[model samples]
Target: MTTDARALVPLPRSGPATAAGTRFRLHRAGIQNVWQYDEQEFAFGDGRLLLRGKNGAGKSKALEMLLPYLLDGDSRALDATGTGRTTLAWLMLDGFEQTNRLGYLWVEFRGTTDGGDHRHLTLGAAIRASRSTQKALPTFFVTPLRVGEDLHLVEGGKPLPVDRLKEIVGSDNITDRAVMHRSRVAPELFGITDATRYRNLTQLLHRLRRPTVGDRIEHGGLASLLSETLPGLDEDVVEKVARNLHDLDAVRDELGRLERTDTALRTFLTSYRGYLSGVLRTSAQAVSRELEVLAQRRRAAGDAAQRTSELRTQEEESEARLETLREEEEAARTDLAALHDSHAYRSLHELSEHRSTVEAVHTAAGAAFTALSNAHGAEEGAAERLADGVEHLGSRLAELGTEHRELLTQAEMAGLPTGHLGEAVALPRTVRSQTVETQLTAPDGETHTVQQRSVVRVDTATVQDGLGSWQLRPGHALPDGPTLASALRPAPQPGCGVTAEQVERLLTTIALAPAAETAAHDAVYHDGSWRLGILSGRHHKADA
Candidate 1:
């Protein structure tokens, strides 16, 4: 038996109290009209009892009539010796002169019920044996009738018949059925309600009964008796086990097959995923190249448009100035016609001729000063041109290296197998990119916004000494450049269609002033640098 999954030792006082606080102590046990004696009885000491007798003195006979036979009504296990020699028929018929016999075996238990009340329960068997029939018929009973006090199994020296016992104990208290007698003893006499546990208790009691007590004390000792008495599993119970062991083996075989299938699939997918990635990466690189080419065309178109817009503005300005000069000329001609007919004009003619000569001299002096300033500016412009050329050379070197790397990458990617591109060669992925807005002053002095956009790039490289395998490599991104937007914005605008790359070439023409502290109209800043245009005092940042 177990409680909370822990095994219980069959030790005394290990369990809780029984119902009604009852304890059924064997008060007396006896038999009559069945064996050597016409009537016999024994009393127990404090519920513990022992029998003592010489060989052939009917002690074994007395035990055979009362024991498990009375408890279970089983005549086969009556001997207590594990021997089948002693039986109900032999006990009732042996040493008897009478052709027919009627007998009884009984046990009385005295105990207390709830509230300290006295109680007595009697378990008994009535036996009838006939010489003519060569058989013993038994009827069992369990009742609250106290033996020797208010109930008796015998009267007039012969055991009472079943009718006389039933009349005394009542039909409800007596049963001819062995099963009913056994069922009542556990609950009514011993206060044990659980049928299975009661059955086990009785079985253990039967197994532990000692038959060789005399021999054990004289020869074997207590240790030997206990060692020999401990029970082991029955052969029949052990045989039924392992009947389903073969079914478990079949399930294990199925699991082993599935594990092998899983391993094979994992191996194939590892190689296939690499091959697929390589093919996809090659396609992406080709698309990037095409995009770069298209971008260059767009930049060229934009530059052309800028130049055309600037030329149109210049033409319009020239026409307006020419119109103003023509209007001034017509007014001068009308004034001259008036002067020809006036005396006042004739008087100032000589004075006007002298004033014109003075103005001519002033104009010549101013022209010489202008030529001197132009020569000085030309010398400074030559030095600036040299610095500009050096910067351009450095930029060209970087661009050339980039171009070389791109060409090498293109050649390598071209070797990949992309013949089945449309047939699921590509893997779709959600691409995340960064796009920031920045201000750019175009070559024609037009200010506009452009997006500086970039995304992470994935590349596939062939593994060394491998069979059709490629490894993935991710490209690191460059850091963002310095801000060039004015205080009015302080940051780049977003969602502008113009890309930095498109106007980058024109932006490079405006030299950046490295020494300038901040942006102003005279020291303009654009595209990540400050720009003080070629020895300029003041330069227009932009108009609207």
Candidate 2:
């Protein structure tokens, strides 16, 4: 008959006790060892189990054998004190020198289903130790058992043969079946399927065995434990909260950096504002100076406009004067035309041209008349002397004739020379005398008488009166005679109605008319001359 170890001491369940949930009650654990525990059973209580033994009594070895089954083959739980090895085979003690020994451990559990049915299970593993190799070797027979099953059990204190164990659990299953079987049983026994939660629970249990500050329980450890041990807490929510806290810290750091950048930007704007203010002030002053200059220019322009107005007024006055001058010029030209048509001017020109001819004719006529008069005087004197001589001769001849008559009477009486005397001669028949008469004719067919007795005389008053009618002076009168001079000279200054002075004035005005018109822009003609105005800014004679 088998003995139950739960009656000695019981361990409290870490979670719910149900077949589907991860909770179980450990009823007992037993170990059989060649060097230490020949056959030992440890019972669990509500909270703890105590095993009091001497040195080399397999106290730690018992825990090592139980750890592979409890924590699903987490070898870290089987670490020896000084061996530096962590395998359950290594954790098993070697037999005395030159001795072979067999070792095994078994743990039994009871679980309750949700339907209130209870199930009993037994987990077992076998190991072999060789003194020569000093190594413990695990058998693959890690089997699950019911309370009444009789497999790999012997009646006496002799060990189960390796062949019989291999017959029960095949050699091909030896590599990892013991550990894999524990992992499969752990979820059902503890209501924890996640490897991380299972690891935490095992660490919690180990830390509870030896308490330290480094092994203190944190919220994560508590959360993991509660997620498996308690009925209502969710593990995913706890993990999500932890991740959200990390993201929040990163965002807070980014926000701090942004605040510092914003402060720098504000400082830059302040400096820029001051600089812009200075620039604007300078620009405004420059604009003000320019405005003042423009104002001065505007005043000067007004003065210039006034001057222009005065100039325009002067221009208008000059234009009026020029118009009057143009009329005067036209009148002068008309007068000049009339003067050209005047008979007085024409007669003056003719008389001037013929003055030499008239003088020449008068001089020649005077000379000829003078010579004829001198010759006539000489002829008259000679005729008188001749007459005197002829008279004296006649008297003498008469006297002589009387004497001769007496002498002839005597001679006739003598009759000697009377025939040669031939009667008394009568002064040789008296030389014959003839008188020549001359006449002078004028251009009018009137004749003047000139008689010469060896001399001639001319009538000057008649010639003078005759030719005096041809004079062409301004106040000379026409001749009242039928002569060539009367025919040649018309009424003195004929055909000219104006006085000489007026004609001369008109001619002068015509000669200066063009110059007056050119300079008339700034001057005026008054009376008989050009007079410039001061407002026109120029002074010039119309005739200049």
Candidate 3:
């Protein structure tokens, strides 16, 4: 680029605070008017000096101005622009525990002309809440200090115009990289390498309040990254949170197991109900057949009416016998009651409450016998239920095992992954099997195989259409397949008792297949079976 063109680029205005190629000399630097820490001054020669003070001694604020004067030749020094008071532009010309140390800057300025020599300008800035600004916001002011030809403050240079100075500093904002780096460079230049550590060391450290949930998340984001490099991070609280998450997962797993068991039970009940219905129907049929045979043979059997009459007579005699037995039982009970009411019974009761004792014994015996009988009945029911359940479970389980074995064999043949779905494949019943395999060639020309197994869960989705419907279609059946494939195969229409047009019409009626149909190839015949490869080498595209 031409010199004129280079010069045409707008040059950033320079200020004494950050003037390039300048060295500043401070004969003495200190805060003039302030507390016991203030009204202190120290004189140092040209190069550099270290200033130290105890807490509340006001050394840091002095350092802020002095460093700028030494490095860039700018100090945020208060000067008497008016009577009795100085025009203070800095928001904070004070130092404290948490104050940012890198807010001070100094710059050196050099003249391009030969024999122009160099000059130093120092710039220091601080935030001040200005009521004159909108919303009472804090406005930053850069105070530029310049030492001139007479070795005294130059005109219009002491409290330099902040607006023009900020343009050279890039920004007066404390958060800006230029300002922050300048501030940091000053402290490091003065051997304050670890400013934060220095501050902590100077004070008694105390534990802060516990972190809130949001604070913890933020801490995890930043501090967790350091954990791999740092030790002693996984403390007791961290382990406890991990343990709680683990327990929650265990409970979720238990609940899943229960749901699976419940599903299995329902499945078993469905099959059992079907089996019982079949058995009852068979038994009813057999009973009906025997009755029919007896009816046919009944005419040859003599004295049918006599047999009927005899049966009625036997029924009456049995009724009479039952009535007599009942009368005897009632009479026995009455006699026992009378015996209890008699003097002898009263005498026995007086002896040792014998009648009451015998009654208690009898009641105890009856209760024991009744309890045993109820327990036996409950046990019998439970045994029958358990037996039915086990038998059903075993048969289904065996069937599933066999099916699983078959599927595993098929999956092996297909080179599919095993153990993708556990236990179900080896369960009592398997409706269908579908698996996909992929072969990959390495850069070295070595081939590797990867298999994908899709378990066909036996339910509505698996049984919606026959698995045979999912078989690969012939190449000739598709529009583009015949032209591309080496071998051509034709597909037979499905035997659904309906023409393709009729099915198409039905699909259109239901808004499935649109009325406007295009001839698109869906398959290509390659092996003995038609290859249902939907993609073609050139023109074929996949369904979305």
Candidate 4:
């Protein structure tokens, strides 16, 4: 925690050129508020810088912060000692209890344009650590803006936020997103045109800087990096080499084939040597025949020359006619121009335009009238529907009134309660009902059907309405009347038959008595139809 890296100072200027010719080399790099240093700047002598110090002098730590981390803003690769346990958060927060710390690591390159003009590119990485997050975040940026001159990444003893930094530099020049920074740096710094190659290069740098020899560096990787950075053979040259190799292989095969063919042809010629001699004599006579054909071709050439002369004459005549037509066209154009300037012609044109406008307006009006007529028809249909709905409502109202009167008459005739909600109830035209029957198997393998009944709740009104009559609450008694216990029986299910002891316990506890017999005593009876008040249950728990 107490390690302090020394400041990087440029060696005494021995030469004038910042970097050799147009080649870019490290010029300046530093860490601000990184590790044990608050502010430090290092300058490279020519293209190289030395960090010579004792073991704990923080030389390697400085390289860890500035080298690969600043180069590509990859925190995982920010380990110079090849230790697998280094991190950006550990770099910033290892020595202190501060919850947050911010730092900047940057490297600038000095180069010249092709015209020998001075040029520079500044690559910077901003690292931040938060104790609560236990993580380190980094932002990468590239700009022509030199540190402490054109722009600054720090102000008032604090690292500027990414947004503020963007304002100072530019949105296009600063980015926290790793991909954006990589894509831009590849083009602006390395002149890489494709993203795939740039990504491959980044991966190589990452692996090399991570201090771990993990994945084998394949020839494909070396070939790709060297293919872009180093000069490569021209595509045409490589293709030609491949083609020539293939052609050479084919030529060897063809030569072997031709040698066999030549041997065969020589034997055939030897056998036909005399015949070939006579054939040559005949071929000599055919040459004269060819001479005659040549004479005929000469005659055809003369005819072609004559035809070409005739075409030339015809072309001259056509040229003269074309000239005459052009003259006529020019005269016609002049006449047209004069006609356009005439007021009478102009009036005719205007009249024609007005006629077109009138026709358009008439057409538009007809379309509008048709739309209106359609709207009127829709309105008439809606009115008819409204009338039919009103009539239907009247019929329903009359029917309800007649039904109400009929219910009142029935209530009076049957001596039932009516007119008030507490005394009245209503029933729909159809009532939905459900019934369930359960069959149980006994230990004797005999099936017992349990007599089951479900109560259906009838509709009752709580508000006064002239709708229907009401009936009194229903009541029932046990089938055995006074000796209700005789009718009581246990319905046991399969695999869970009731024990004889349990049946005896139930029979002894329950009383078989009627209301008259146990009226004066407080006794619980075993009457299946038990209660005296409502046969159905109360709907609300509050009522109970």
Q: How much lDDT does each candidate structure score?
A: 0.59, 0.53, 0.39, 0.62
TM-score of each: 0.36, 0.33, 0.17, 0.38
If ranked by lDDT, best first, what sequence of candidates would result? 4, 1, 2, 3
- Mind giving the per-residue lDDT tens digits that candidate 2 earns over 1-544? 1222232333444665333342467666777663355566666653246665555545655676675434454445555343446564444443244367676666777666677876666666666776667666655333445422655445366766767765665564333444565555556566667765666666555544432323435434655554554345478988998898889978899989999998998999899989988998999899899999998988889888998999999999999999999999999999988988999879987997798788787777666556545544554554555445445544544554564465455434332234423344234332222455668674445687755333111122332232232222344422333342344335435543433343334334334433433332122122012111211111121112
Collision count for each candidate, in order: 0, 25, 23, 0
Q: lDDT tens string, model 3, 146-239?
A: 4233222212433223354455444633232333444543443333555444333222111111123346457674355333223343588889
Please report the candidate that would top TM-score against the real structure.
4
- Residue 348 in candidate 1, Cα distance off native in Å: 99
Q: Give the alpha carbon lDDT tens digit for every residue of 1-544 in model 4.
A: 4444343334555667533767677888877887887777887878777766666677767777776666566676666545657788888888889998888888888888998787989999888899998887887889998988887867876877777878887887878887777777777777887877766676665555543333334534655554554455689999999999879978999999999999999999998997989899899889989989999999999999999999999999999999999999999999999999999889999999999998897777566545544543443354344334434433443453454455455434333344331232222222233444657454344675543233333222211121222211234222232343333234434444444344344333222212212321121121112221123321221133
lDDT of 1 by residue, 232-332 (tens): 56787766666656577887998899999999989998999999899989988998998999899889899989999999999999899899889989988
Provide the lDDT at 48 for model 1.
Answer: 51
TM for candidate 3 is 0.17
C-alpha RMSD values across all candidates? 50.9, 42.6, 63.5, 55.5
> If both were scored by lDDT, which would come out higher, candidate 3 or candidate 4?
4
Model 1 stretches astray by more than 4 angstroms: 1-21, 212-544
Instruction: Give candidate 4's TM-score.
Output: 0.38
Candidate 4 CA-lDDT value: 0.62
